[model samples]
Target: MTAMEQGGTGMAGARRLRQPAARPTWLPPGSIAFCLRSWAAVMLALGAAFWLQIDSPASAGVTVMILSQPLRGQILSKALYRMAGTLAGAVVAIGLVAAFGQDRIMFLGGVALWLGLCVVLGTLARDFRAYGALLAGYTVAIIGIGCIDRPEDVFTVAIFRVSAIMIGIVSIAIVNDVTGSPTAWHRLAAGLRRGAAEVGQIAHDAVNGRATPDDGAWLDLAARIMALTSQVSFARTELADSALRMTGARSAMVAMLDMISCSRAIGGVLPAGAVRPAILAAVRRRFGDGTPFADEDAARQALNDLLHAAPADAPPTPAEAYLIERTMALLSYGRWVRDGIRTLEEGRAAPRVARDVRIARQQDPVLALLNGAPVMTGFAAAALICVLGGLPGTTTTLLQVATILTLSITTFDTRAFGIGALVGVPLSTVCAMVLDTRILPYGSGLPFLALMLAPVIFAGCLLLIHPRLMPVGLNFGVFFFIVLGLDNVHNYDPTQFVDRNLHYMLSAVILFFALTLAPPSARRRRFRIASAVATTLRRQFIGRGDIASPALISRQYDRLLQARTWTGHLPRKPATLRVFDRIVSLGDLNGALARARRHLARAAAIPAVAGQVARTQAMLRALHGPDAAGRLLDQAAHLLAAAGHLPPADRETLLGAVSGLFGAARLLDRNARALRHYGILPPPEAAP
Candidate 1:
């Protein structure tokens, strides 16, 4: 061989040595673990059901699939609620059979009304609580409609259904506990820590005037905080001292929201120049990285330094005073965030100040009623069709309709639920066909049956783990078991399979039309949220707002968060964006007024300022029109001048009250156009 050839061979050898080893595809360990646990629970449930000789052994398997969750806490909590819902529904089912068993029309009508009421309640709830409400609705359908032909057997069927659900719940709980699955509290704690850091960063940026996050960013942060509320509830089922831990978690969430409000207010009043204030530099150094103070003394000392950083010789301008008030509030809330996190970690009570602060939730009765209408109407129509057609599987079709409608009530996108059912039913039917004919026929025992079912369950589990594919996976997993129709005596009939699945598909198509015909309007939701905010502001303008600062601010935050959620779903039109921005500004104005009232109540104790406080309250009640903002500024100035003769502490309190009023006036001027548009103020006059 020539030298060139030898050199080429050496280079190839080097390349071969540098190449990495080939490996099989990677799967998430958590997903695999969850799948194995779920599969084991399903097998156990099936074995128990078979031994008991239940009427519908397949229902047990369906229950296990429905209750499957990654976290042990979620599974157990949901199982509890599911059992409660099942029992409540069973009781109602028995009553309906006794009262209207002789009249089919009355029985069906009663079922529809019960389902409608459940849907409305479910729409108003959150998390597993909502699931419980929805489950109660459909359980009535399952029991009452399943026994329409044999009303005498209603009680028997109800007993068997509840038994199957109990078996499934116990199986999953045992499996999860033996496997030592992850706890929700651990995950929630980590999330709370991460959220505190993120919100701290936002506060730091606001103080330094470094960044101004858009509406989307702020809204995203708010959503994360709102989501934690559900997690806190779930975590309560996992620990002994859950009440204390949950109290701390609630405080942390409330503080984070208050911190965001302060950050936004500070951003608006921050000096335009690039030069940062000395106190701001102190704030950035202390909390820029989001680390909480170690103790109360440390937090107090740090805050004291921040307050003294402002010049004592000269009084602050209106904007400067506002900035100082917001900064102080930011630091105090940040300390509360730290304390709350510590309480969660150590499983102790939160500080007394934060223990009483509750996060308020937004409720819309009109929206709930609107959501119930579609479900009720769809059920009525489906019942008419099934009764009129008088087909072989008409009863089964009505059951499917009730299930789909009740389940879809909890989901934001009903169309997706329909689409998932449409695609999943056929796929599940085909898989059941192949499995029944080729696989299950060759198996004779429970072990062999579980072995054959493993791959199908695993595939469904993989899809279920993905967020985007969850709806499809849910439908596939649930319908596969139902369509398979597993029992003590396996009758593999191809015709029965095809006929049953056709009815299921028909129900999905009906759901699609029912949901799409008059879907909940995004524009209408936006208008309602805006109207709510305007009503709140109008009440505040007339001195009818809540007196407690925490309650007032918490309620305002809830409304603003709801607005942010709906606005994201609307088309990104300029007008819509403007309306959302105006809503946020209004929230800030609301907060400023709340804080002003709190401080005014304090300043009222001083005899020197009592007369001025009375006049200011009267003026606030009569506030309106485009010129109302100017009058507010004038009144705030007068109050400040009157307090100049007081001592330092009293004068400082008076200044806080005046500063809040000034900030409110400025915000009112900025949002005057929106105020008129929402009918909170008189509309502009036409030109002469």
Candidate 2:
């Protein structure tokens, strides 16, 4: 099934475009209880209809379906949200009718007021939570303000629509539950493992600079991963995976994004060798389960010696040691989380390794504004269409808008919900005209058509559950019912309805395009890349330290691996992905350079190696930065590259050559700095 989801706003955000893999062995004819949830839903829907004075079974069905979205938790939340929105909208609708039934001008004010409030709510909400607020605003437009002239029928129509949604929700819930369909929670956890593993695997490819399948693979997979993540994140409180994993994945994602941005500015830089071999090895070895740590005592003993290592009288001395220590801490945490899982607290408990990243508004307001343009444009179009509908009364306006928004959200496969709705509404009108006008056999056939459609309804229900394609089918189902409910059904013209819906679609598309075309407010791509560089720097400087102790080294490599995995996940604009690729390479370069620095630092400690190593380190620092470091790296690369290959130099000498940037970057941090300190900043080849 095509997994539709929220927009891909973050750098390398979720992958909505990928086709879901073949179903695992655990699927097919469901259990008996699957029917129970739907049964309950039907009861609840009927009760709601009775209490709210809703007039039709169709209205009840809509209500049931709206609330019966598989996940009991989400189902309940939606139910509450729907109820609150309906009640609130009904009150406002009643007020508008009381005030504006007398004045057309006042009705517009009411419509504007309700929508503005929904917009406000949408702005603050995250994930599915925003839907309710959006619905609240629209419901008022659909039920109250749209039918301003027909004040008396407001409650009846409103009640009816709510009832219909309830009925649909109930029917589906009972059917689903009785069939023993998998719960969202199980899917959520399963998705995390699959997503995380895939993240690790694909990221390893990018990190190692493997060019095949590439970002397209990740991109195809990311949307669904994210959508699943969101679903799992919000599934029952029992669910425990951080929507964002705690460790390097966060930083990796950030760096990848930054790298992408930086490359855009610089152009065509691929980090073909940026990935650490250890990362690829690790990704391949573990898949998504994470590295086996055995137990805490084992982990502690492994880290004990590494943690005690003191700074040496050499380049990268302090930095490498620090890198070693930080990595150990993270590894221990991962082991801790793993142990918790072994105990079966699964979703109910969290592992100590749960290094969930802080979802900060990493970008400023300007960036946020840029990203929001698409959604805002969608809203604007919705408003204009309402004004243009020119329906006779508020009731007609309310019903159509409800149908429109619901249908609008259905075209997720095409990545344009607004456009989808526009297309769907007309299709619905045609279906309505065809079935209600052309085919129905007077009064006797009405019930018979509904009964015959039971099978079609079942099939549509199956399709509606799909993550991606469901919206299209769901829209069709509701529209099918909506048309049957229209009183002037027999006289309806399918062509005219289609024409109106097409324009409705235009409004949605205009909004979508407007938003998509707007400049991104945040440079998430830049952060992802920068973070990647940082991870590499940390690991490379600590090079060889891990070798002295496999466990400690494995832990450190794990952190680097984690970061690399997520960096690839940051949102990817076309411009950003290229930048990200370069950053990945740069990240590898940074790691390699750090290892060089560590060698220099250690090599300098040798009795006969001191002077040469110091010189190498000094030269390297000079070449790598504006000061000494920049010059040093430049000299080494120039010297080495010119020599036709790496020269067989002393380990200390190579280390010194690479630590130059480390020194300069350190100095820059200690003092306001730039890379232009020419006097002291000389490359190995150029240094006096």
Model 2 TM-score is 0.56
- Model 1, 398-496: lDDT tens digits are 898898888887676677777777777677777888998777877699999899888878878877777666777888887788889897888877777
How many clashes show up per model? 0, 125
Off by over 4 Å in 2: 1-53, 67-74, 95-101, 152-179, 195-228, 237-291, 294-297, 306-330, 340-415, 438-450, 462-471, 486-576, 579-688
TM-score of 1: 0.89
Cα deviation in Å at residue 441, candidate 2? 3.2
Highest-lDDT candidate: 1
lDDT of 2 at 31: 19
Best by TM-score: 1
TM-scores vs. true structure, each candidate: 0.89, 0.56
lDDT of 2 by residue, 615-674 (tens): 665544434333533444344443222221222234223323333333223333322231
